[model samples]
Target: MTLELIDIAVQDSQSHPRLAGRVTGHVRAVLSEMLDGREQTHELSIPVWADIADGTSQSDIDLALMLKAAKIVARLKLSLQSPP
Candidate 1:
């Protein structure tokens, strides 16, 4: 399976560029791991937006993004099995 990440946009009030980069990195890793070895022939474009509030911990952000990535992968798998 081929996976391409077009873009990741993060919005926060604190304007933490470093934190945003970390979040996107974590997200990309999670998505890559989840989509690895999948039998996806066509392209699937999934746009995910995450909002990080002030005072949120890094672990919490990572967990939430991982869950979101899992959900996206699960939904895609289901859709691929359905008839057109």
Candidate 2:
């Protein structure tokens, strides 16, 4: 899907802002060890719409949705680090 669509999905989560907080928390937890000392940067790319063809399975569709949500959360975190 296009970045605009992904952005829209992220915006939708604003209605439940706590979801963003939870996602950020989980991310921090996962990286806590690596973040303990010194500063580091990492790059990630999540394909929200991959292997989605005419007859994609329901499970695959669900996974794509989850990936899209993850992408949204990552975007939210990055935005937080930006200069305001």
Candidate 3:
């Protein structure tokens, strides 16, 4: 199985200082869970980016990113468990 990180956007980090850490923690937890108890070897790449902008609270952004990560992990896990 292959894991791909499409995109990650963090806006106005200067305004909300904790946004970066929160997002990182969330993504890390998802990845940890996804990789736990797995025996197969796979390729993984995560490319992230940041930018300055406005709008959206930190909590909202965290929730969205976490959900997106969970969905990706679920899809990957299903693919790995299925018959080739």
For 1-84, candidate 3 gives per-residue lDDT tens digits of 344444443322223355633333335321322345463433333222233235766766655655565566667768766486
Minimum summed lDDT over a 10-residue window in model 3 is located at 43-52
Error at 56, model 2, angstroms: 0.7
Q: Model 2 TM-score?
A: 0.36
lDDT rank, highest first? 1, 3, 2
TM-score of each: 0.43, 0.36, 0.40
Which residues of candidate 2, in runs, are more than 4 Å off? Answer: 1-51, 82-84
Candidate 1 structure quality by residue, lDDT tens digits, 1-84: 344333332222233465553334333422332245664333333344456776778666755665666577677656655365
Q: After superposition on all CA atoms, how large is the RMSD of candidate 1?
A: 8.6
Kindly state the number of residue pairs that clash in model 1: 0
lDDT of each: 0.48, 0.37, 0.45
Query: Which is the winner by TM-score between candidate 2 and candidate 3?
Result: 3
Which predicted model would earn the best TM-score?
Answer: 1
List the pairs of residues colliding in candidate 3: none
* Cα distance off (Å), candidate 3, residue 27: 0.9
